[model samples]
Target chain A: MKILVVDDEQDVQVLFEQRFRKEIKAGEMQFVFAFSGENALAYLNQHEHEAVLILSDINMPGMSGLDLLEKIKKTYVKPPPIVMMITAYGDAENFNMAKNLGADDFLTKPLDFTLLKEKLKTIN
Target chain B: MNFDFLLIVFVARYLRTALKNTQQNSVWDDRLKLAMYVAIALFVASVIFRDAETIMAWVGHLCLLGCIYILYKETFFKPAKSLIVAILPYAVVATIIQFLQLVLPSFYRGNHSMVDSLKGFAVLWGIGVWMVTIKQKKELDKTNEKVVQQEHDNRIITAMKDELEVQVAERTAELTRQKEALETALQELQSTQAQLIQSEKMASLGELTAGIAHEIQNPLNFVNNFSEVSNELIGEMNEELSKGDIAEAMMIADDIRQNLEKINHHGKRADAIVKGMLQHSRSSNSIKEPTDINKLADEYFRLAYHGLRARDKSFNATLKTDYDETIGNIIIIPQDIGRVILNLITNAFYVVDEKRKFGIEGYEPTVFVSTKKRIDKVLISVEDNGNGIPQSIVDKIFQPFFTTKPSGQGTGLGLSMSYDIVTQGHGGTIKVETAVGKGTTFIISLPI
Candidate 1:
C-alpha cells in the first residue's frame, strides 16, 4: 500500500518517517510526503493512481484539507483514491465540513498510529 | 435840636456795631459803613448849628445815594446768578420811590397845607420803604447763600459719579479675565480626561487578544512536548522489538499509545480554546467580575518577560515593576485586561531583545511596568529603553495593518485591537510617548 501525508510543519516529515520506517523497509507499505496542500496537488497530478490513501491536515495557511478533498473528489472519478482529513481539533464543525466535502474519514492529531494502521489495512 | 443831635450820634454808633457783627469781607461793605458815618455825622452837626440846615441836608442826601450804590454792588456783583432777578425789580422800585418822594413830592400828595403833615406822609412812606429795603436785603442774602451751597453740592455729586464709573469698569475687566482663565482650564481638563478614557478602553481589548494567544499556546505546548517524548519512546520500542524482548516491546508500545491519546486530547483542547476566543470576541458576553488589578498586571508582566526569555536565550533585558497597593481590586473582565498587559509587556520585551541583538555599546535594555490608582480611575504604564519608534510613524502605530516590524514577525493587529478594546470596551484611554534613541512609554487608564 502507498500513502501520501500532507502537512505544513516540517517536523511532521521526521515524525512520519520514523513511525513507518520498519514498514517501509520491510516493503509492507510505501510513504510519500508533501509539506502543503498545493504541493500534494502538484504531486497527485504527476502520479495520479500511485497513492492508495491520502492523509491531509485540515488547518493550513492556504488550501485547507477540506478544499483539497473537494478538489480530489470532483476531479478524480475512475479509481478514486481514498482521502482522509486530519486536524488538531476534533470539533463537530470541522468533522461535518470534511464529511460534506466527501472525505473518506476524519482523524484528529496527535494521530493514533495503531488505529490509523487498522483504517489503512482496508483501504485497498 | 441839641437832643436830636445826640440821638443821631447814638444811631450812628448802633449802625457801626451792626455792620461790624456781620463779619463780611468786602470793600463795598466798608464804603457802606463810611457812608453811614458821613450821613449821621452831618445830621448831628447841622442840628448843633440850626442856621446851617440847608448845607447839612444836601450833604446827607449825597451820602444816602452813596449807600444805595454800595448796597447794589454787594447784592448783585458777588455771586454768578442768584440776585439778577431781584436786581431788576428792586432797582425799578427804588428809583420810582426815590423820584416820587424826593424829586417831585409836593405834586403827588393832594396839595393840603392845612394837613402840613400830609407832606409828612412822605416821611411815613420813607420809613415803610426803608423797612421793605431791609427785608429785601435779607432775602437777597438768603438767595446768595443758597446759590453757593447748590454749586458745592453739584461738584460733590459729579465727583461721586466719576468714582462709581471707574469702579464698575475695573470690576468688569476682572470678571472677563477670570472667565477666560476658567474656560482654558476647563478645556485642558476635558482633553486629559478624554486621553485617560481612550487608554483604558485599549488596555481591556489588548487583554482579550493576549488571553487568546496565550490560551491557545498552552495546549500546543503539551502536544509538541508529548509528540517529541513519544517519538523517543517509539525508538525504544523499535529497538526492544528488534532485540526480541516481546514483553518490553509491548509495554513500550502501550506507553506510546497512551502518549498519543494524550496528544489527541490536548490538541482538542487547543481547538476548544481557539473557538472560545472567537466566540467571546463576537458575543461580547464576558461578565465583568472583580479582580486584583495589581496582581493581574504583575502576573502578565512576568509571563511576557519569561515567555520571550524561554524562546530566545541570547535575548536579555531587565524588568522593573511598581504596583499601587491601594488598588486592591476592581471590576473588569480579568482575562481581557490580562491580555492587554501581556501585549504591552511582550512588545517591550521584543524591542529590548532586538536592541540586545544589535550589540550597541553602553546600552542597557530595560522594561518597566507600573500601576497607579487615581481617585477615580486606574493607570498602567509600560516603559522600555530600546529602539523607540520614530516620530513620523508614531501616529500610525495604532492603525490596523500598520506596523514597523517586518512582515513575518507581526500581524499588525495587536495595537489596533488594543486601541478598540480600551476605548470601546472599558471606557479607557491609551497614550504613547517615544524618543527615537531614548525610550517609549505606553500609558493605559481605566475609570473605576
Candidate 2:
C-alpha cells in the first residue's frame, strides 16, 4: 500500500520514517512525504489514484489539514483514498469533522506507532 | 564727559550717604567712593586756583594740555579706551605742571611769588590726586579679574550639575525600562507555569473522568437494557391479561414493575453527574479561526459558572454581561480563549462564592463581564462585587501556585493562564484595578 503523510514539522516526518523503515524496505508499504498541506494537495493532483492512504496533520501553514480533507473529499473522483487525521491532544474536536468528511480514523501526536500498525494491518 | 564726572561724584556721595544710613550693608566696595570724593575735591580746587596767563601758556603747550585732558579723561571720564591714548599725555602734563610751579615765580612780582608758591602747592595736590586715582584703578582691575575668575568657576559648576542631571535622567529611564522588562518576564514565567499546572490538572481530571465515565457507562447500560426487557415483559403480560390469564399476567406485571423502579432509581442519578463530567472533559479542539469574541465569552461564562454550581450547591451569584455589539469577530483559537475565559469566570465565581460565605444579610455576590472596542483594540473586563482582594495579595494573584484557597481546593493556575492568553499568546495586555473594600476589576486588551 502506498501511504502519504503530510506535516509541517520535519521531525515528525523523520519520526514516521524511522518507525516504519523496515516496512518500507520490505515493500509492505511505500511511503511518500509532503511537508505542507498545499504540497500534499499538489501531489495528490499529480498522482491521483495511486496512493491508498493519506495521513495529514491538522495544524500547518497556508492550508490546514481539515481544509485539505475537505478539498480531497470534494474534488477526488472514482474510489477516493482513505484519509486519516493527525492532531495534537488539545485539538481533539476536529476528529468529528474529519469523520464527517469521510476520514478513515483520527490519531493524536506523538503517534502510537503500534496502534497505527494494527490499523494498517486491518486495512491490508 | 565733564558732566558725567560731576554726575558720578554726586551719585557716589549720595550712595555713600545711603550706605551710612543703611549701616553700609551695600556690596559696593568703599575705596571706589573715596577715590571719587577725592578726585572731585581736587578737581574743584584746581579750577579755582588757576593763573589765567599760566593756564593760557599750558593750553598753548598743546602736548601738556593734551596730557592733562587725557589724565582727566582716563581718571574721571571713560575708563576703558581713554587709557590707551592717555599714558604718554599724563607724563607730559605732570612735567609741565612741575615746570609751571618753578617758572611762574620768575614771571611774577616778589609778593606774587607767595601766590605762585600756593599755586605750586595746589598743582602738587592735583598730581597727588592723579597718583591716588591711578592706584585705585589698579585695585579695581584686580577686583574685576577676581570676579571674572569666580564667574568662570560658577559656570563650570553649573555645567557639571547640568551634566550630572542628564546622566541621572538617563539612568532613571534605563532603570525604568529594565524594571518593565523584568515585570513582563515575571508575568510570562507565571503564565507558562500556570499553563503547565492546568495541563497537569486536566490530565489528572481526564483520567479520573474517563474512569468514572466507564463505571457509569456500565450501570447506565444495565438500566437501559433492563428497561427494554421490562417493557417487553409488560407487553407480554398485557397480552396474557387480554387472553383471560389473570394470575400469570399479574405476577409478570409485578416483576416488570420492580425492574422499572430499579431502572428509574439508578439511571437518573448516574446520568446527571456523568453528563457533567463529560461536559467538562469535552473541550473543543478546533484550530484557531475567525470567531466571535462575544459568543465565546458567553459560552465560557455558562460552562464555568455551571461547573462551579455543580461543585458547590450553595455557589450562587448574579452574572451581568456587557458585550460591545460592534466588536465583530477576530481570528483566534476558540478553544484556548474559551478555556481562558472559563478560568477567569471560574475565579470570579470563586471570589464571589467566598464572599457570600461571609457576606452580611441582604448582600448578594455579583460578577460582571464586559467587552468594549477602541480603535484597533478590544477590551474585555471581568469584575466582582465581593470582599475585595487584599492589597498585599493583589499583585501576586496571577503568580503560579499562589492562592488563598486551601491546598487541594485551588492550584492557582487560572488567572496566570488567563494572563498568558491575554498577553503573550495574543500580544495583548492584562491589568488589574482594585480597592480594599470596593472590589476588583480585571481588564484584558487584545489587538483587533
**lDDT tens per residue, model 2, B82-104:** 33243333345444554656677
**In candidate 1, what are the lDDT values of residues A1-124, reduced to their tens digit?**
8899987665565466656656766798988999778799999999999988899976543456766788889888878988898855435666787888888887776677777778877764
Per-model DockQ against the true two-chain complex = 0.03, 0.01
Once model 1 is optimally superposed onto the true structure by TM-score, how far is the C-alpha of residue A70 displaced, in angstroms? 2.2
Q: Residue B134 CA error for candidate 1 (Å)?
A: 14
Model 1 error, position B93 (Å):
22
Tens-place lDDT digits, model 1, residues B281-382: 442565678888887776566445544533443455666789889898898876667666777887887887788687888676788999999999999999
Evaluated at residue B17, the lDDT of candidate 1 is 49
Instruction: Pick the lDDT winner.
Output: 1
Q: What is the TM-score of chain B in candidate 2?
A: 0.42
Model 2's alpha-carbon lDDT is 0.67
Off by over 4 Å in 2: A1-124, B1-62, B69-77, B80-116, B119-123, B186-190, B193-197, B235-244, B278-448
